[model samples]
Target: MLTPESAAKFQEFTQAAMGRQTQVLINNSVVTEPWIRTPITANRIRNYCN
Candidate 1:
Protein backbone atom coordinates (compact mmCIF):
# COMPACT_ATOMS: atom_id res chain seq x y z
CA MET A 1 0.00 0.00 0.00
CA LEU A 2 1.17 3.49 -0.81
CA THR A 3 1.22 6.16 1.79
CA PRO A 4 -0.84 9.21 0.87
CA GLU A 5 2.28 11.22 0.24
CA SER A 6 3.81 8.60 -2.05
CA ALA A 7 0.58 8.14 -3.92
CA ALA A 8 0.33 11.88 -4.51
CA LYS A 9 3.86 11.97 -5.84
CA PHE A 10 3.17 9.04 -8.12
CA GLN A 11 0.06 10.77 -9.40
CA GLU A 12 2.14 13.81 -10.28
CA PHE A 13 4.64 11.66 -12.13
CA THR A 14 1.94 9.82 -14.06
CA GLN A 15 0.26 13.08 -15.02
CA ALA A 16 3.51 14.37 -16.41
CA ALA A 17 4.31 11.12 -18.25
CA MET A 18 0.90 10.34 -19.57
CA GLY A 19 0.82 9.11 -23.16
CA ARG A 20 4.57 8.83 -23.23
CA GLN A 21 6.89 5.88 -23.43
CA THR A 22 8.84 5.18 -20.27
CA GLN A 23 11.32 2.63 -19.06
CA VAL A 24 10.93 0.47 -15.99
CA LEU A 25 14.22 -0.07 -14.22
CA ILE A 26 15.39 -2.22 -11.37
CA ASN A 27 18.86 -2.22 -9.84
CA ASN A 28 20.09 0.08 -12.63
CA SER A 29 18.86 -2.37 -15.27
CA VAL A 30 16.18 -1.62 -17.80
CA VAL A 31 13.22 -3.96 -17.41
CA THR A 32 10.64 -2.89 -19.99
CA GLU A 33 9.59 0.14 -21.97
CA PRO A 34 5.90 0.85 -21.98
CA TRP A 35 3.62 3.73 -22.88
CA ILE A 36 1.74 5.47 -20.14
CA ARG A 37 -1.92 5.21 -21.00
CA THR A 38 -3.40 7.57 -18.42
CA PRO A 39 -2.80 9.45 -15.22
CA ILE A 40 -3.50 7.56 -12.02
CA THR A 41 -5.36 10.01 -9.81
CA ALA A 42 -6.69 7.66 -7.17
CA ASN A 43 -4.88 6.37 -4.13
CA ARG A 44 -5.88 2.80 -4.92
CA ILE A 45 -3.29 0.11 -4.42
CA ARG A 46 -1.96 -2.09 -7.17
CA ASN A 47 -0.67 -5.62 -6.79
CA TYR A 48 2.56 -6.21 -8.62
CA CYS A 49 3.04 -9.77 -7.39
CA ASN A 50 3.19 -12.40 -10.04
Candidate 2:
Protein backbone atom coordinates (compact mmCIF):
# COMPACT_ATOMS: atom_id res chain seq x y z
CA MET A 1 0.00 0.00 0.00
CA LEU A 2 1.29 3.40 -0.91
CA THR A 3 0.63 5.92 1.80
CA PRO A 4 0.63 9.65 1.06
CA GLU A 5 4.11 10.22 2.37
CA SER A 6 5.68 7.19 0.75
CA ALA A 7 3.97 7.93 -2.54
CA ALA A 8 5.14 11.50 -2.42
CA LYS A 9 8.70 10.46 -1.68
CA PHE A 10 8.70 7.93 -4.49
CA GLN A 11 7.34 10.54 -6.93
CA GLU A 12 9.98 13.01 -5.86
CA PHE A 13 12.74 10.45 -6.20
CA THR A 14 11.56 9.46 -9.65
CA GLN A 15 11.33 13.06 -10.80
CA ALA A 16 14.77 13.95 -9.47
CA ALA A 17 16.40 10.84 -10.90
CA MET A 18 14.78 11.39 -14.27
CA GLY A 19 15.99 14.97 -14.41
CA ARG A 20 19.58 14.09 -13.56
CA GLN A 21 22.06 13.19 -16.29
CA THR A 22 23.98 10.88 -13.97
CA GLN A 23 22.56 7.59 -12.77
CA VAL A 24 21.40 7.18 -9.19
CA LEU A 25 22.35 3.96 -7.43
CA ILE A 26 20.39 2.89 -4.40
CA ASN A 27 21.73 0.01 -2.30
CA ASN A 28 24.50 -0.68 -4.84
CA SER A 29 22.01 -0.91 -7.73
CA VAL A 30 21.07 1.68 -10.31
CA VAL A 31 17.62 3.01 -9.45
CA THR A 32 16.80 3.91 -13.05
CA GLU A 33 17.89 0.50 -14.24
CA PRO A 34 15.14 -2.03 -13.66
CA TRP A 35 15.86 -4.82 -11.17
CA ILE A 36 14.01 -6.85 -8.59
CA ARG A 37 13.40 -4.91 -5.40
CA THR A 38 11.99 -6.00 -2.10
CA PRO A 39 8.33 -5.23 -1.55
CA ILE A 40 7.42 -2.60 0.99
CA THR A 41 5.74 -3.76 4.20
CA ALA A 42 3.61 -2.09 6.85
CA ASN A 43 6.05 -3.38 9.44
CA ARG A 44 8.72 -1.06 8.07
CA ILE A 45 6.32 1.87 7.98
CA ARG A 46 4.86 1.13 11.40
CA ASN A 47 8.26 1.13 13.04
CA TYR A 48 8.97 4.44 11.34
CA CYS A 49 5.61 6.12 12.00
CA ASN A 50 5.31 5.08 15.59
Candidate 3:
Protein backbone atom coordinates (compact mmCIF):
# COMPACT_ATOMS: atom_id res chain seq x y z
CA MET A 1 0.00 0.00 0.00
CA LEU A 2 1.24 3.45 -0.93
CA THR A 3 1.07 6.50 1.33
CA PRO A 4 -0.73 9.57 0.03
CA GLU A 5 2.54 11.40 -0.50
CA SER A 6 3.97 8.55 -2.57
CA ALA A 7 0.86 8.43 -4.76
CA ALA A 8 1.12 12.14 -5.46
CA LYS A 9 4.75 11.81 -6.48
CA PHE A 10 3.88 9.00 -8.85
CA GLN A 11 1.21 11.10 -10.48
CA GLU A 12 3.66 13.98 -10.94
CA PHE A 13 6.17 11.64 -12.59
CA THR A 14 3.62 10.43 -15.09
CA GLN A 15 2.57 13.98 -15.93
CA ALA A 16 6.18 15.03 -16.62
CA ALA A 17 6.75 12.01 -18.87
CA MET A 18 3.61 12.75 -20.85
CA GLY A 19 4.66 16.37 -21.29
CA ARG A 20 8.04 15.34 -22.74
CA GLN A 21 6.41 12.95 -25.22
CA THR A 22 3.98 15.63 -26.34
CA GLN A 23 6.84 18.10 -26.90
CA VAL A 24 8.74 15.58 -29.04
CA LEU A 25 5.69 14.78 -31.18
CA ILE A 26 4.61 18.40 -31.70
CA ASN A 27 7.89 20.33 -31.85
CA ASN A 28 11.36 19.39 -33.18
CA SER A 29 10.58 15.83 -34.23
CA VAL A 30 13.24 13.13 -33.99
CA VAL A 31 14.32 11.33 -37.18
CA THR A 32 17.19 9.35 -38.63
CA GLU A 33 18.87 9.40 -42.04
CA PRO A 34 17.49 6.85 -44.50
CA TRP A 35 20.90 6.20 -46.07
CA ILE A 36 22.30 5.17 -42.71
CA ARG A 37 19.35 2.83 -42.18
CA THR A 38 20.05 0.64 -45.21
CA PRO A 39 19.52 -3.08 -44.59
CA ILE A 40 22.59 -5.12 -43.64
CA THR A 41 23.99 -7.29 -46.39
CA ALA A 42 24.70 -11.03 -45.92
CA ASN A 43 28.50 -10.54 -46.00
CA ARG A 44 28.35 -8.04 -43.16
CA ILE A 45 26.58 -10.53 -40.94
CA ARG A 46 29.14 -13.19 -41.89
CA ASN A 47 32.02 -10.87 -40.90
CA TYR A 48 30.59 -10.57 -37.41
CA CYS A 49 30.63 -14.39 -37.08
CA ASN A 50 34.42 -14.56 -37.71
Candidate 4:
Protein backbone atom coordinates (compact mmCIF):
# COMPACT_ATOMS: atom_id res chain seq x y z
CA MET A 1 0.00 0.00 0.00
CA LEU A 2 1.24 3.46 -0.81
CA THR A 3 0.90 6.13 1.82
CA PRO A 4 -0.07 9.72 1.14
CA GLU A 5 3.52 10.80 1.44
CA SER A 6 4.65 8.25 -1.09
CA ALA A 7 1.98 9.41 -3.49
CA ALA A 8 3.11 12.98 -2.98
CA LYS A 9 6.68 12.01 -3.72
CA PHE A 10 5.59 10.28 -6.87
CA GLN A 11 3.67 13.37 -7.92
CA GLU A 12 6.74 15.52 -7.35
CA PHE A 13 8.93 13.24 -9.41
CA THR A 14 6.44 13.20 -12.29
CA GLN A 15 5.86 16.93 -12.18
CA ALA A 16 9.59 17.54 -12.22
CA ALA A 17 10.08 15.21 -15.14
CA MET A 18 7.22 16.69 -17.17
CA GLY A 19 8.20 20.24 -16.34
CA ARG A 20 11.68 19.52 -17.65
CA GLN A 21 10.29 17.66 -20.66
CA THR A 22 12.19 14.54 -19.69
CA GLN A 23 11.00 11.03 -20.31
CA VAL A 24 9.44 9.50 -17.21
CA LEU A 25 10.08 5.81 -16.82
CA ILE A 26 7.84 3.58 -14.77
CA ASN A 27 9.31 0.48 -13.25
CA ASN A 28 5.93 -1.24 -13.36
CA SER A 29 4.38 0.72 -16.23
CA VAL A 30 1.09 0.39 -14.33
CA VAL A 31 1.52 3.79 -12.83
CA THR A 32 1.48 5.59 -16.18
CA GLU A 33 -1.63 7.65 -15.47
CA PRO A 34 -0.47 9.25 -12.26
CA TRP A 35 2.97 9.69 -13.75
CA ILE A 36 1.45 11.82 -16.48
CA ARG A 37 -1.16 13.61 -14.37
CA THR A 38 -0.83 15.83 -11.33
CA PRO A 39 -2.23 15.49 -7.77
CA ILE A 40 -2.38 11.74 -7.49
CA THR A 41 -4.11 10.38 -4.44
CA ALA A 42 -2.81 7.63 -2.18
CA ASN A 43 -5.63 5.30 -3.22
CA ARG A 44 -4.67 5.70 -6.88
CA ILE A 45 -1.06 4.85 -6.18
CA ARG A 46 -2.09 1.89 -4.04
CA ASN A 47 -4.35 0.64 -6.78
CA TYR A 48 -1.59 1.04 -9.34
CA CYS A 49 0.82 -0.94 -7.22
CA ASN A 50 -1.73 -3.65 -6.62
Per-model RMSD to reference: 2.9, 10.1, 17.5, 5.5
Query: How well is each residue in 1-50 modelled by candidate 4, as lDDT tens digits?
Result: 55777777866766666634333346845343333444444445343433
The digit string of per-residue lDDT tens for model 3 on 1-50 reads 44566656645544555523221122566332122232322221121211
How much is 29 displaced in model 3, in angstroms? 31
Q: How large an RMSD does model 4 have?
A: 5.5
Q: TM-scores across all candidates?
A: 0.66, 0.37, 0.34, 0.39
User: What C-alpha lDDT do the candidate models reach, one value each?
Assistant: 0.78, 0.48, 0.36, 0.51
Ranking by TM-score: 1, 4, 2, 3
Off-target runs (Cα >4 Å) in candidate 2 are 19-32, 35-50
Q: lDDT tens digits, residues 1-50, model 2?
A: 56778866765555555534444475987655332133333322222211
Error of 4 at 9 (Å): 0.2
| Residue 36 displacement (Å), model 4 | 3.9
Q: How would you encode candidate 1's per-residue C-alpha lDDT over 1-50 as one tens digit per residue?
A: 67899889988988999999887677999767767788877787453535
Backbone clash count for every predicted candidate, in the order shown: 0, 0, 0, 0
Against the hidden true structure, what lDDT does model 3 obtain? 0.36
* Residue pairs in candidate 2 whose N, alpha carbon or C atoms collide under 3 angstroms: none
